[model samples]
Target: MLIHHHKTLCVCDFTTLLELSQPKISRHLAQLREHGIVSDSRKGRWVYYSLNNQLPDWCQRVINETYQASQTELAELLNKSLTSESCCE
Candidate 1:
């Protein structure tokens, strides 16, 4: 969802959207990064994540399909975004 809407998102965004603990989110993100599904960049004290541009076209299509199939999940994320904490300056 983050990749779909914002293209990139800080760790805080995922924690806020999923209502999960930071450590758990970080762990999952680490796994995703390790698998080359996502990539990260550090800015000041925050790390932002986005879909890896190096991923195959088929993989990108799969992501888009998954996102499209997750309408309810995306609605939940949208609701969370309205009141979610942000790491943006």
Candidate 2:
């Protein structure tokens, strides 16, 4: 789940929340763009993204609820695992 709230966010915001480098966040955002999960538009030098309204309700729900930082300590664990997996790929 992505932590993207209702606001249209910049890449820097994504990096800060994901605790990842700007380039890393950019790559993931690119992948998400490819899947049509997030749509981007450029305003000057910045790019903003938000969940597409065209998606199924379930997808929007996931993105909406994803912002509530996971509680189980499993979130940090899973984040580590995900980082490792992405780094290796």
Candidate 3:
């Protein structure tokens, strides 16, 4: 969903969007960061994550395609993210 929206999101946002705990979200994001799949930036107390633009074209294509294929199921989560307020605020 982050790839689809092309926006940065914080752990709190993922907690809200995915209905998961903050630690779980943070752990997954940390792993993604370690793998170079995502990049993070610290903004005050919040760390926001976005897809790594430096990814190879083939990797980008795969992520884009996966997002496309899952769009139907992800529609609700995407909508929720847009409409919901970030806890960071």
Best by lDDT: 1
The reply for model 1, stretches above 4 Å from the true place, is 82-85
lDDT string, candidate 2, 1-89, tens digits: 44343256677655645677989888988998999888888877778787766889987776556555554543553454233223212
Give each model a TM-score: 0.88, 0.63, 0.88
lDDT of 3 by residue, 1-89 (tens): 65457478878877877889999988988899999999989889888899998999999999888988887888877777444456787
lDDT of 1 by residue, 1-89 (tens): 56766798887888777889999999998999999999999999889899899999999898889888998978877786624437554
User: How do the candidates rank by TM-score, highest first?
Assistant: 3, 1, 2
- lDDT (C-alpha, whole model) for all candidates: 0.83, 0.65, 0.81
Return whichever of 1 and 3 wins on lDDT. 1
Cα lDDT of model 3 overall?
Answer: 0.81
lDDT for 77 in candidate 2 is 38
Give Cα distance to truth, residue 12, candidate 2, Å: 1.0
Could you tally the backbone clashes for each prediction?
Answer: 0, 0, 0
Query: TM-score of the candidate numbered 2?
Result: 0.63
